[model samples]
Each structure stands twice: as structure tokens, then as C-alpha cells.
Target: MGQKVRWGIIGLGNIARNFVKDLALVNEAQIYAVASRDMGKAQAFSKEYQVPNAFGSYKELFDCKEVDVVYIATPHTLHSELTIMAMDNGKHVLCEKPMGVNRVEVQKMIAAAQRNKVFLMEALWSRFNPAIKKVKETVDSGEIGSLAYLHADFAFYALDRDFEGRVLNPKLAGGSLLDIGIYPIFLSYLLLGNPDQILSTSNFHANGAEIQTSIIFKYPKAQAILYSGFTSRSEMKAEISGEKGTIYIPGRWHEAQGFTIDRNNENEEIKLPTTGRGYYYEINEVHACLSQGKLESDLWSHQNSLDLITIMDTVRKQNGIVFPFEE
Candidate 1:
């Protein structure tokens, strides 16, 4: 709808800062405005990123006609409410992962996007990574030959931090399952669609938030083991094993640097270098999709987002992790 994709950033946090830096790599992308609850912070982010406008309230950013898209970098709990507000005001949205706290909120966000005729997508940036792209290609090519089992994990130690920190606060929808856990879950779903059955367990912190979680997904022909935690760091390697061979993505595989293939008694390494810390690809995707007037990305479609959240909801239900917002 505009010559350049003008971006308005909501919630100027650490991730927001990283995204702004990544925006520099996209020729057709620009950060036109920023919003935060604190006027000072908003102004600081605006000046730091050379954004032309800053708002103390999200409402102001949404109402600004110059903002063609709003990238939501708020905590997990606030995504549903804030995304709906942005879409209702005719702004396209690229929300951070765990698109909503639950499936219901995701449903509402999708409905709002459709009703307002604005594009909306979850910022599952890992899906757009080049290493992951190549891995998916290998899987689809049947190089793996009927995926049988997969193991993936994401974890980090942050239990000693203040209870109110976004990683451990229940009010903010804080938990290993929602934050780091989504990576493993996405890997499983991407390699194998929605599982036929899900079995999960979690270790809760003193504050009742999940500190660790392990999930098992059973498919008709395959099974996946996925885990995430906040009390310790995991290697964060992802592997897909099938009848023919096993594919291994190096550590921190969610934002992988490269991958190795083991097939037919032979092994080979494939390397992919990321520019702008790997956030540039997703930004470019948003620019392309919005310019084409698409409501959602086919790669990360609305139904796909729904499917991931629904699996998360089921895992939460099984683990007895309830968010206060759930009715």
C-alpha cells in the first residue's frame, strides 16, 4: 500500500532492538515509529533506530496512518490483545513467537485480521532461517527417507533472576514451555505435522511457573522427543532420523549456522551464513507478502499457527500450567 513498508514497533524491548537492527538489511523496510508504555523509552528507541515518530502508548502507534506494519515485541501474554488492537486499526502485524497465550486468543487475532483485511503472521523467525530451509528441503527430498524419530531441545539457565522477569513471571505468561519450548515444538511440527498423540511433563518453579518441560509426540509412523527448560542450558541441537539416514543441525540449531547429513554411509556438512543476525529473512518475507496483499504467509499460515498453539494448549493442559487469562 506504500512505496516502502513502514514499520511501527510496539514494546521496545531487547528483541525489539535486535529487530530494528535487522531492518537495516531490508531495502524496502523502514522503522517509521516506535511505541512503549514509557515515553522516554519510546523516544530513546526512535532516536536509536532513526525512527521518525515515537508514541508513549500503543494506541497512538496503531492510529498513525504512516505505519504500514506493526512488529509486536511484547511479552508472550500481551501479544493477543495488542495484535488485535493493531489489526483493528488497519495495520498489518508480525507478532513474536507463541503468537498468543492459547488457541482462543490466536483464533480471535486471526478473525480480526480477516475482518480488517490486514496481513498477520507470527514472527517464528527460526522457520525462515537458511539452515532450517535447507534441512526442510532435505527432508522433503526424502533424503531422510520416512522420518522415524526426532529429538530437539532449547534451554537456558535463568532461575536465579528476579521473579518478575519475563522468563519466570506467570502474569506475563512466563515459562520454559512458552518461551524456549516453542522452538522444539515447531521443529517437531515442521518435520512431522500435528502429532496423533502428545504426552508431556513439567517441573514447576516455586512460583508455580514451569521451569522445565519434556514432551513426546506420537505419529502413525514416527515419534518425536522434545524438551525445554530455564534452570539449565541445553545443547539446542535438532536431529531428524529416518529409515535411510539422520540429519543433524549443529548446536543452537534453532538459529543454526550449518547442518550435517548422514546418508548411505556417507556424511557431508552444509553451511549457511546469516546476515543481520538472521532476522533479515523474516523481515524480507513480511515485506514480500504484504506487498503482494496476502492475508497470511503460506509458509507460516494462520492454520499452521493455530495448529502449533493448539498443541501447546494441550501440553499445558496436560502439565497443569494454566494462564490467568484463560477462561
Candidate 2:
């Protein structure tokens, strides 16, 4: 067996809870420590996960010599700050996506990695998803013919939640766009590359948090229709259509279980099961890269993270969906 990669995680939120469960499934990963602003919360998480150490603040985890990498699961606004801190401490990073609140922050994070000569990656787990990977391969192989159109959406009913919560809180950079919109945007960008033009519309709450956003990315040979909102539940299915046939990824396509291809008016289904909430794949990628003494995964390189943020930045600029931190 290869040497285990010691991981320290910060932010003990719902997403972090799911991530820890999946981390347990990766044989080469070790829960060296976890940190949170609240010492009590940090201790509780460490006890629950059976981690070796717990720290009251993020810097403690970064300074810990036993921890080789840190997973930043904090709010979008805090991503850049925490990731750079980790890298500056000579620890690698797997910061959760959007990677930053905007493109500038992402660039800073990437620069930190290069300056420190440490690994860094946005935790965009979907990029390593088996079903999505196969679909990308199929499209690249010309099996789907020349792509003409793509449709993908991600939405959930969250209007009833507390206004002060993350979903509606401008201070936290909370909104549907960065929260769920990245999925559809990722699918479109993966299949069609950057669009020639992008048009977008957004609705905002009284507090200036963007509640909903619909975007259209126009390519020379193709177009993508994407939507993300907190107004109501949307069909999370994703469709990529071409001249010869169409490929359909069923609901919750970001963590899709499988996909289908329709050719000659016949539908053929394919299943690609993932291990443990689909985070194991990315965790494995990180381990593989670390073992190979690499700074980033080729599958989801630094450029990919920057491009994804750049696209969202354009969409935000078009619709006036500015986060407070960016100001």
C-alpha cells in the first residue's frame, strides 16, 4: 500500500458531514485533524469522526505538521482566504467550489500554490464523476455527432428557509448561482468549451441576494440553456443534443448515477455507479496526484477552475449579481 495522505478539514457544516463519510471510504486518506472557529464544535466533530486532533481555529490546523492537506468547506467568500493560508503553510488544499467569490480570488489561490510549490484544487467533485467522465469521452469521440444544444438545470425549494441563513445572506455570498448553478454551467462548458456569447437574467431578494438565475451560452455551432434558483424545485436532468442523437443524464445530473444515449430513435442506457456520495473519486484523485508528487490533477487543472469562475463572473456582471465581498 502507498503512504496515506493526512487530511485536515475545516468547517463542519452539512456538506462537510457528507464529505467525511466519503473520506472514510478512501483507503489512502487519513483524518489527521479538523478545525472550526468554535472549539466545542471542533472537538465534537473530531470525536464523532475519530480524528486524531481538533483545533479551535483554522490556523492551528494549517500549522500542524501531521496534516499534509486541508479541505476548506467554508462559505464561498472564505474559500480564497483559507485556501491560500493552507498553501502558504506548505500544506496542500482541496477547497470546495466555486473556489472563490470571483475570478480574482481564484487567481490569488492559484498563485499561492505555485509560490508554495504545494498542491491545490477546487473541490469540484463532479469533474471526477464517472458518469460525467464517460459522457465527456463519448461526446469527444463524435458518437454524439456535432453538438447542437445543451440543457441542464439545478434548483431546490428554499424560499421558506430563514432569510439570515446562507442561502439568502449576502455577507456569506449566498445565492443559487454559486451554490447550484455551477453544475449546469460546468456541464455546458465541458461539452461545448467556452461560448462565443453569454446572456443571463437574475432575480434578487430584498437583501440583494440573487435568488434565481437563467443563462444562455451561445456557441458558434451550439447553444446551452441553463437555470439555477431557490424559488422552487427544478428537474435536475441534463440533456446534450446533436445532429445524430441526444444524450440524457437523469435528474441530479451533477452526481449522476448513469446516462443514456439516443441514436436512430432508440435509447440505450448506461450505468456508472459511484463510491460514497461520489466524493471518493476526487479524494482518490488527490491521493494519486500527491503520490506522484504533482501540484494539481490534470483532470481538473487550475485552468479549468479559473475558466469556470470566469464564466460565472461574466454571468454575474450581466445580471448585477454582485457579492458584498467583491465590492
Candidate 3:
């Protein structure tokens, strides 16, 4: 626990770039190091981001004594390994989503964090988005009444790329479900607790990765219709219907925007502008937890991560999609 929390970026991907850009907005955070499999890439990213140090390998970043935390932006299959490595080296971890390929991997990561007595969280950055926060607040205020159903989807076209790319390759744990699907799934989990049952279907590429997926999550009195895909584009809008009224979150609903609440007597729009890409909020949460000597974020707790991935696991299982790492 120091005056400033020093963080290291583990992969030089697009998400990492967004995260670093957001870190600039956090006064309590400092990007001290970056690591990538390629030394050239690592050095380039460090230079671009003005990070203090660059490492040719993730292990080097983990070993750096000055790095208080590691932001894991590696692929889904690598999340468990890199997270455990950082935790073993006594560094807190902010791992990217679909925290693991399965429940077993997530459990191992959590075990390492507990054993090391360090902080760990799945970087489901959407939960910290300004728009989503306002939606949750409105629902909790009893204005939304009893939740009836929720619908969300995230989709984008990546089919024309190399079949070996991460989104289509089985070796890298590629699939729409893990890549973009986790967002809508996470939304459902946030608005409604884990459902009582899940019915999922997906169209698989010849290589066996899920290309598109649709899920129906059934609860006692509520339901969620969710979709994700790599073969097409979606509106990316999210809707939550409650007994009293409805809340509409605009497309890219997970990010900086607002929501409109339709009540019995009136309709109102709420706007929330975010700093940077909104990853800054999660970084702020991490800094606060570390400053307070806490091990995980209350907003995105370990159990919540487990629940999200568990739901994903079930969806994948239902669709007959399994990664090589799982076997």
C-alpha cells in the first residue's frame, strides 16, 4: 500500500492500449511497466505509452518489485496462467474477462490470489461503465419495479480474417461466446442474478468454434435473451423491462452514455459522461481496494466472476464448444 498504485500491462493488445489511455486519467495510478512476448512490440508499446520499463516476457514484469499490480490483457486461454503467475510473484491482478476458459481455471486463479493474499479481479469493465451504473441505480431505487426481462447483444464481423486468428481459432480459445458474448451474458447476470436455467444455441465454424450464439436465460419470474457473434453485426442495444416501466440503454450499452426510464406516469433520460474509455473507473476501484488493503472489488467480486464464467461454461457446453485447453 503506497501513495500511488503502480501497474504493469501484460499484453500489448488494443484493450491494453485503451486501459493505458484511461490510466492517464487516474491520479492514483501509474503505468510502470509493460510486457509482451515480442521484445520489439513491448518496447514500442512502452515508448508509446511512456511506461517506465518494458519486458520481453510476462515473467519479467511479474518479477519487477516496483510493479504493484498486473493488468492481464492476454488471450482467454492465457488468463489463468498469467494471473496465477502474477499472483505467485506477489502482484495484484486485473485480468481480462471470461476470466478463464472454464470454472477450473477460474478456481485456480482465485486459489492463487487467496494463497498469495493479493488482490484479483476479472476486468469486466462494463460493470463500471457510467451508463450501466445509472441503469443499476434506477432499478435498485424501486422505480423499475419487479424486473421482468432483459435483452442484450454484442456482435461484430471477424469471419473474413485468417481462420487462425484468435476469434476463430480453437487453440487460442477463440469464439464469439468468449470474445464478445461475455458482455451480454455479464449484463444479464448483473441485471438479474444467475438464472435458474439456460438454453443456448450456436452456429459453429468448421473448426468448431462458436461463430454465433443465442441464449435464453430463464428465472422464476424473469428471463434474459442474449446474443453474441463474430459472423455478423448487432445493434448492441440493451433493454431491461420491469413491471412498472422499462430502461433502454443505447447501443454499445456497456460504455459511456445514458439510459431512459419509462415509468407509470413519465419518461426521463439520464446521461453520464465518462473519463477516457471508462477503464479508468475500474483502475480507480483497484486503487481504492489496494489502498484499503482489500483483496477484491465489491463491485466485481470473485464470486461474481465465478458466476459469470460458470454461466459461460454452461452455454459453451450446451453448444458443444470446448477449447483445447479444457481437454
lDDT on C-alpha atoms for all candidate structures: 0.92, 0.92, 0.90
lDDT of 3 by residue, 1-327 (tens): 577889999878899999999998898888899999999999999999899899998989999999998999987889999899899999999999888889999999999999999999999998988788878888888788989889999998988988887778999999899899999898888878899999999998888888999999999999999999988889999999999999988888878478888888587988888888889888988888888899999999999999998999899888889877667
TM-score of each model, paired residue for residue: 0.98, 0.98, 0.97
Q: So what's the TM-score on candidate 3?
A: 0.97
What is the C-alpha lDDT profile of model 1 across 155-182, one tens digit per residue? 9898888889888999889999999899
Candidate 1: worst-modelled 10 consecutive residues by lDDT: 318-327
lDDT of 3: 0.90
Q: Give model 3's clash tally.
A: 0
**Tens digits of lDDT, candidate 2, 254-326:** 9989999999989999999999899999999999898889998999999999999999999999988877766
Candidate 2 global Cα RMSD: 1.2
Cα error, candidate 1, residue 12 (Å): 0.9
